[model samples]
Target: MKRRKYPKANKMMLVSLGIMTALSLPIQAEEEIFQLDETVVTATRTEQKVKETPASVEVITRKDIETMGAERVVTALKLALNLNLSEASMVGNQVSLRGMNTNQTLILIDGRRMAGEDAGSTANVYELDRVNINNVERIEIVRGPVSSLYGSEALGGVINIIMRKPEKPQSTIGLSTGSKQQNASYHLDLGKQGKWAWTFDTLFTDIQKQRRSETTNMYGPRQFYNISGTYDLAEGKNIDVFYERMSEHLKTTDYTDDGGREYFTNTRNSYGLTYRGRTTRGNYELRTYYNELEKNTDQLEGPGSYSDFDRANYKTWAIDGKNTMRLQDDHVLTFGGEYRTSEYRGTRLEDNGDAVSTVTEHGISKSISEKSVDYQAVYVQDEWKLSDKLLLIPSLRYDDSNRFEDSLSPKLGMTYHFADNFRLKTNFGKGFKAPSISELYMKMTRRPIPTRTVIVIGNPDLKPEKSTSYDISLEGEKGAAFGKLTYFDNDVTDLIGTETTRAGSVSTSKYVNIDKARIKGVELEAGRHLSNNFTVKTAYTFLDAKNAKTGEFLQDRAKNRYSVQLHYDDAQRTGISSILWYEWVRDYRYKDDEDKDTDYNYGTLNFTINKKWNERYSTYFGVDNILDKKIDELVLEGRLWRVGMNYTF
Candidate 1:
């Protein structure tokens, strides 16, 4: 007799099928189930239940974050449908949603923009790793373009991190450690006392670096702290202020130097003040904020060449206000305006020991070599309840900038209750992403090989990237069962790419709007409850991404992806609990450092068990990548273990 070993993908499929079958068995649910009463504010700037939103939205609660052992926002979103995540190397750890590129995604904290690499790219991406989950109350994810509300980088989607604000007095402390990682966190909430309240939170994390022959880049320790306070002026009127800061150490081992390493620290600091009040028929908010990002090097122990620039800094300041009014029982209107300024500063050493940076705003002939830009935007939206079962929303926005042509974004959204416990939702919109300072006015010189020299230049005349987006879905919720099916399509133009012109051994590359593309996908998610203690959910996505002009498939776009989760807990919400999660990805292609095509598929399984000793103490333990899966040593980490304990008072 011979024994057969089943592949990991097959094992995942089997587990999924078994769970589906088990959910089909005849059994009565013991208590209330499904997400029916949850309210979200991102979709329309109005408080509405998840089932009433005009777009597809997913919410991750605080319980989900602790149960899954997710350290950061990126880890919690890894298994979500329609999101493409790269889990391999330090430089490639990014997530793209709806087949759109990484640069088009927007991340917000309490409705304010976060830091972007400080100076990482010419793109609009925030380092999701810097956001610790300790203070997060919930995360709201809205799929598809939301330019009508957020403007610019809202082309792909929006992710909003909502911090915890206590409804009652509370204090919590947590400690956790892993095979190569460790964390400590504290949170304190002072419930409203006579008209004043405040909150404080802090987190620290340290992890061992991942190195293969002392070449690949790595991640290091990080720290975060946040504080906020509110003062009440009267009934329905208040003033709020907040401050936050974070720092992360980034490292890369030097292969040329025997005992050398290169590293830099990314630091972010932000603060804001806001005023809110409600009248008899409307509510309004006015806010002002400032954010700064910088990169610092460690010149004492290693070389001072972690980035192209010796030092880099980016800063942003904004004043924003909005008001929503209820005119009639069936009519609602919302409008707002904002003014913002963004500046970038950098200096680099030349081959001759002199600093280089020329401030020119004209063309690629000279590096933008220059400074900053300012923007002003205004937007309006109208919502109409035409009938008992139909809702229509129309919105428009105009953006004016000092550097480029003005842009107008318009969107239309519809929701119809076609059947009991089910609704049909659709959204059509136009979105855009402004060219970054590094993209519009950049100039760089590089020597790739002994015989070749390359110079890269930026174009100041470049237009912003644009996209036409559409999505339709049917969502339903019933007794212990919930499901959704969605179809998304995005056609993009004025895509920014590089073009090379070679003369002899010297090559000149310039940025231009030289390409067009199309990204379309189908997403399906379904879940059911077996009883009060057990619940199961599964999601699948199929993506087709391509370049319109070349008709070639996009790099790193997986054709199929799947995830399944099984959860067990106490009916009273206090006792032992467990979560078993599995995810599989298939048919994806990527170009490695050497520019060689690497095609592969992989799966991972994770488990966590938690116990509550009493009202004040709890503990959890978990294992990730239980099968010890590995791919080319550049992807997922092998098996890892973690344990943690928490106390509340």
Candidate 2:
């Protein structure tokens, strides 16, 4: 690995340390103290406090989201430690966790999986934009392999979003405007005990295009809508349904002398239903869902003398069921099964003056082409309490797919209390990811001109990527302070890579299984609540990732990252509250077009102040990137000011 000199990085670290010291100095005078014991459910199928969970889990509460003034789910996720964001053309932004690529992370809503692939083999991070932040109760992140619970796509970790359940009648309306965007949202909850319950939520957002010298955005307007409902059938039985829709339209101006234009449009729809009940044995849930996505692009050049069009569509349907049982006082069991099917279709057309042709890969051209795949899986897990201070959990899963071979994954975890307020935890798990639809059957062509041609083909014989992960941690608490230190290692086999072959003048690229890769990292998180109204929190992460076969460092992974935040609530002592946050991301390396390492780094500061005028209304004002720190190519918008008001009835 190569190192680059960054003078600012050291300064940023010192700044954070200085702030912590300053805050601690004033704590000795304060007598009141408070501790946090946040509840989380993603680590296991059942709910438990973050401190009790065997795995390292992070929880982002609704109050945290509101204090940060985050308008979208992606914005809130960016604040998490060790998570990196990357930009992908046409497919929006992607996220990498624990030095693993985007595809290795699995995202879920209410314990159900989301679609894992896009039209061009890109990961589906953009789909997160559809989730209404105002309706979310909380988000739980488990940062390690959980394939024993989830089937595939859990090599990196899992993010589960839990929606709020309406218990009483209430309503809220909010509107916010910023330097680059505008948003409005409405939420209504109406219900009566033992009868029926319903919840309605909707949000609308608009973003303006931005352009700078040598750096411009081709993206355009976007909109999202979500609706959900629930009904109670009996004393312990209920049904829930939800629907979401998203769309975007974009146009880009040509930078060349030809003065060409490119138009692109993308739309997605998702809906699902779930039936839940509590029986004498335990609790059970059954769910079914469907999702569809469509993308289209049109290009015009040289005063309409040349034209081209491309279109792609993807759809998926799934059914899942799970049951939890209590066999004894100290033993609990959970089992689940799932069935899913997915389909993909794409078409391309080219027109040049006297001739019109359809572009294709491997001389197989058609107006429209289609492919489909199906999967079935079952899993079981058990939690055993060996004694008052020791606990053990074991999980296993089996999956069978029409497009690939069968797979089996297993995991074991243990937790032991070493002292009054300290515990030791360890986990070992196996994970796997099946080849995506686009990677297995996609047929696309690039640069269809006669002067130069490049074709991309999909290999149906590609094997599934697999991994083994191990981690151990020590966590404890004293008085009003809590801290945790963790170390983890993940080794992956049968890695997927793209191979290009050229015959004569035609070049072809296809997906294949490669050798081995490994990632090792250490994390430290500490926080202290000096008083009931004042608190401080910080985290640091160090990662080392490489390809074991080639001995080359992985691309686009930061070796060191850290975050610090200071918060004050006042507990309505003065009817005013404020929060100050500072974050610094260490320099990371990436391979440019010429395969040379390039370094990128930056830091940001944000502050928000809130005032509750009365019981009916409250207002907040905030400034993001107060120092105006930015990397033009990486950041979409910089140094923004926003104000918003919320009305409750």
Q: What TM-score against the true fold does each predicted structure earn?
A: 0.90, 0.90
Report the Cα lDDT for candidate 2.
0.76
What are the per-residue Cα lDDT tens digits for candidate 2 across 1-649? 3445678788777776565444334344545465467888778787677777788788998776776666777766756767776554334566677888778888887876665354334675575665777788888889888888887788889888888777678898988887655788888888554566777777777665555333344556677676777778787898988887777787665555356667778888889999999988789999999988887767666566445667667788999998989889888899999999987666622221112335553334445666778999999988898888998989999999998998899999899998988999999999998887777765667664446677776778989899999999998766667677899999999887788898877888877887689999998777788677777888778888889899887877877788887777877723667678776667566775468876667667888877777776878787878998755445435687778888889
184 in model 2: Cα distance from truth in Å? 1.6
lDDT of 1 by residue, 365-447 (tens): 22222367798999998888998899998999999899898889999999999998899999999999888766676666655
Looking at model 1, report the run of 10 residues with the lowest lDDT sum.
Answer: 360-369
What is candidate 2's CA lDDT for residue 301? Answer: 60
lDDT of each: 0.77, 0.76
- Candidate 2 colliding pairs: none
**Global CA lDDT of candidate 1, please?**
0.77
